[model samples]
Target: MPIPPVILAGIARMGMTPAALIWGGDTHQELLCGYIAAILMAFSSIASYLPQMKETGKLGFAAVFITAAGNIIISGQQYGIWAYGAYAKEGLFVDITGMLVGIGMMLGTILLAFVTFRAKVFPLWNVLLFVVMLVSFGVPGLESWFALFWGLAYGAMGFTIVSGKYRNKEAAAANSLNLAS
Candidate 1:
């Protein structure tokens, strides 16, 4: 409903569409564009996270690699170029790369949940809510529903996360109690 949620949904929908298109054998320039968009989204997310290291930690190489894999899949499909080299009929390497990226994304999400939980930085309920959204993005055969749910869930969760951080800051200023710096 709000801007952040809309962005979150867009990211999930973008991610889901490429996989669906490839699985349906509908590789096209559109897929390539979506892949690029996904990477841009990842980068933007990473950049925005720079100042909020405590709230959203730094993006790791694995995150970059996973996002790159999505870009490669779409680019390969659109232009017939494989990152590893000439495409073989078997496509073993490409498939493996994609699956690995997917796994990385899943694990990264779990890590997010763990970090937020351990820090007690956000409401427990909201943390659970975000996890549900993250999971929906990867659930198979429910692309549209997943996108919708994730978009709304993460959008709300993101706002809550940021708001909680702000509240912590305010609380610290008021109490003169140094938070975990």
Candidate 2:
């Protein structure tokens, strides 16, 4: 899907450098490199699942593949194009502000996970909430490490559920028997 112009503009605003540190490079190249890295990660996750694909329900596995593939395509294209635009100004405040936002997001994800686990329910709405949480925190002026990590966490949650490994032997045994006869 084509990204909306507003989001595209926002992506363009991100550029290569954060608010601090002058790491010089061709902006387009940096964006492309980052995009490739993310894509590689997504495919690697899929490849890792090759041995256990059938045991995992196809519906859940397909959802994971879609999430990973979609995230890479959207993020890569938007950021790749945006890097060609302006870079942000550098300062202590900028760095600190970004770091704080990243920390907040990381904490928020933890809180959400905690609540879900304690409630003993992994609802689809909860997953959507997590996705919303990631997008809200994934803006520019944040630490890339934190942004990417949360983004990944959001994606991985789907895989965890679909793999059926999250459940005890009761569920797995039932599925195995169902598959057998």
Candidate 3:
């Protein structure tokens, strides 16, 4: 989560949308990294939902699902494959699909962050980082490097989850599970 451009640089997540690749330079490494980063991004976005649901209830649940939907769309697209490989020029459908998925993913991520903020489960800084990462559209010439911050934001959250740093809800979750058992 902290990041990897091709691996640890946050896997080259240029724009999380095929539209970004339209300007070209979608090489094998770039495509591979982008896809991988996108997958991680989706998972990272969804991870915040669990803790929030306890505090915000259905509102949090909705955000989680929406974010997941968007992530799934971004992950499932053939944008990377289409942009760099043999089928690069085959059809317009693929690009259009990627673009649409990007839109959904953007909305999902934004909503999820909002609910998580309301829930107050994660650290304030981490939440802010995630929000910033989600909304930071790159400037005209600096798009390639934008993934660094995104990676940092997600990476930090990943670390937080792993360390159980601010996981107040998880303790309750464990007790609830034990009671059920």
Specify the poorest-scoring 10-residue window by lDDT in model 2. Answer: 4-13
Query: What lDDT does the true structure give each of the candidates?
Result: 0.47, 0.43, 0.58
- Candidate 3 achieves a global lDDT of 0.58
Candidate 1, overall lDDT? 0.47
lDDT of 3 by residue, 22-125 (tens): 54545555555566776666565555555454676777667667655665565555454645575653578866876776676566666666766776667777
Query: Which candidate, 2 or 3, has the higher lDDT?
Result: 3
- Relative to the true structure, candidate 1 reaches a TM of 0.52
lDDT of 1 by residue, 101-132 (tens): 56765665556555555545345674576577
Higher-TM-score candidate of 1 and 3: 3
Cα lDDT of model 2 by residue, 1-181, tens digit? 5542222322332332342124434355446544544454444434323323344445435544554555455454436354545443246754675555445434534444444433333444434545554665556655443334333443444444445444333544454456577
Name every residue pair that clashes in candidate 1.
none
Best by lDDT: 3
| C-alpha RMSD by candidate, in order | 6.9, 12.5, 5.4
Using TM-score, give the best candidate's number. 3
